[model samples]
Target: MQELLEEALATLVPSDAEQAAVAALCDSLLARARKAAPDGVEPLLVGSVAKGTWLPGADIDLFLRFPEGADLKTEGLALARAVLPDGEELYAQHPYLRGSVEGYSIDAVPCFAISDPTQPASAVDRTVFHTSWVHDNLTDAQRNDVRLAKRFLAVAGAYGAAAAVGGFSGYLVEVLVHRAGDFPAFVEKVASWRPPVALGAVPGAPEAEITLPDPVDPGRNVAAGVMRDGLARAVLAARQFLAESTADAFVVGAAERKPLGCVTTVVLPHPGGVEETALPHIQRQGRKLVRALEPFGVLGSHCSLGNEGFIVLETAVVELPERQLHRGPAVWDAGAFEFLAAYPQAPLRDGRFWALKPPRHLDIASAVQALLPKARVVEGLADGAEPLPAA
Candidate 1:
């Protein structure tokens, strides 16, 4: 296990040239930001690079820290735009700039650079402080453990705390590694986790399937965003990786939802006019479609970057028949008459009201499209984008 892990670290760790390039990029961004930044504002390069846990070819996160008097959004955007003129203005807790620098992706985010970590004003404001905490607690050897843990979670399809990924974050994995003492130990612990696992100084009912509290902020749940299915997959992966100890168990790839039936592709035109911003929403929308498809017996799905600038979801379910029976409450129930009235021809059978419901739509894509107008059923899809690939 140790030998395989070392091999993985060799491949996953950033190369010296890549490090130099990222450092130069960060320095350049800081240099550009200092000129346009408001008074008393500071530029800080945070994330894995700062903590020495970054992977090869990973994006750089450069944040502009502002004083209380500074308009963080405006000043940060100004600084970022000055650096990357065509940068798109994005938002999370606060507005930030996202663009490419010399073919490498960069996120120029803004946050309140507070004096104390415990007194952060916003969610992301404590990230740098968290990075510092990890750096202080982790040794050079432990950083390797973090990298191994990250790859393990990622391969298990339970990595990333993004809205789309809804799994574990690199930082969360790092904390797990620290607590468990090493990568292999971390796997052993996760493999032993019962559902609703909580780890912290104080543990109670878990807020999520597995609860791992933020070390810096005890009140905050670091694993709050992790979904049950993803965590289950990670648990399974840990067991499998323990048994196998093979590199294949830690492959860098997206986890595909297991297929249940004939796959249906839901394609939407590129929403953001650009790929990076649009792709997340596309993947998110695909997950939403899968959720909506559950009632129709859809089991799982896979999202993809479709050809011709479209976002695609190849799902595991297809359309039902043109019409189906909808069972209603008992004849004496309050809503029974209402169901009869709505269906008009609904009849009592075995003391229950039954109605032959009209089809939502004969075509699955059309059904999804019709539903989208009444409700934005998906997180990433913009209004008016249609689903495609009939039948």
Candidate 2:
């Protein structure tokens, strides 16, 4: 099952343009690093992208470990700007990693020293960043598991890989490791995942495609717009639930508190009940919000894209609902505004499904309410919305 799931998720790898951009960026960064440090060899690619387990629309991950005790900022930042050019516009500084270069954002992470290759990063964050092994080591299964784990999250809109890194979860890491069968089997133990509903797997008339009117790029079509909207609404619903539970306001609060920093969205699942008719609009707003939240923390989920729920990782589970609901990005229609307006706290179940546990912080109610308040409403099946009884 783990191997099967990994295979399915691997299908979502990035387009040729994205791959090229990343490769060019990496080569440039390496050039700059070698120039800056005469004694150093070139930097290496690490993380999901390096592992060849990255999902479609994932970021480029690179690792530059200067000889022990060397400062990475000088070499790393120089490489970053040289590749990206406009630091203010394209690059954004991250927590541990240097900064994300624009145009398929690339993460230039530094390598920390680790004594043992066997031990996990959880046990030794200060000594070594796990991404080192993610970039350097790992068997073929482990690499596949990384791709699978990322696709699961990317489709779920839990962690926008190119946008931020903090949203990455420990559970996801554990699940990937287990699935790879390198050590304990965590993914096999929690083997349920939601599959994404195919939106435009086939193309018809271009005029009919329901994508968002690209504000920045008018040439952009609408089927992708509809998909983005659906994903945005789904993500918003998850964020709202998290805010209610954690009391950690998203963009608004984060902006006021930390002007220089960005806001992070926790990945939680939503129950299916209401219609998701505003996927286009939701996607547009969601993308805009993502830009705003970039300085804080780019947050999202790892469930499949649409309806088939194989496994889900609900993070920040304190004070969470007992049961959680989930839906694919395609399941969200323009009609979601109707029920979501009436039932702020109710589950919107159409083609939607449920996860084994209630998502804690990824609730989209509050965010949706803020974004789509006119559509807010109290729902009927609000009391006990459990996962549809197992097949």
lDDT of each: 0.71, 0.39
Q: Tens digit of lDDT per residue, candidate 2, span 217-316?
A: 2343222322333334334534443344221211111212112222122221333321122222333444544443332244332222123111111222
How far in Å is the alpha carbon of 280 misplaced in model 2? 29
Cand. 1 Cα-lDDT? 0.71
Q: Model 2, residue 195: displacement in angstroms?
A: 25
After superposition, candidate 2 runs with Cα above 4 Å error: 1-10, 14-25, 71-83, 88-102, 109-142, 154-188, 191-391
Tens digit of lDDT per residue, candidate 1, span 209-255? 76766888776777787877668878888888777778876676533
TM-score of candidate 2 relative to the true fold: 0.37
- TM per model? 0.77, 0.37
The candidate maximizing lDDT is 1
- Candidate 1 stretches with Cα past 4 Å from truth are 32-39, 201-206, 254-260, 268-295, 302-363, 373-391
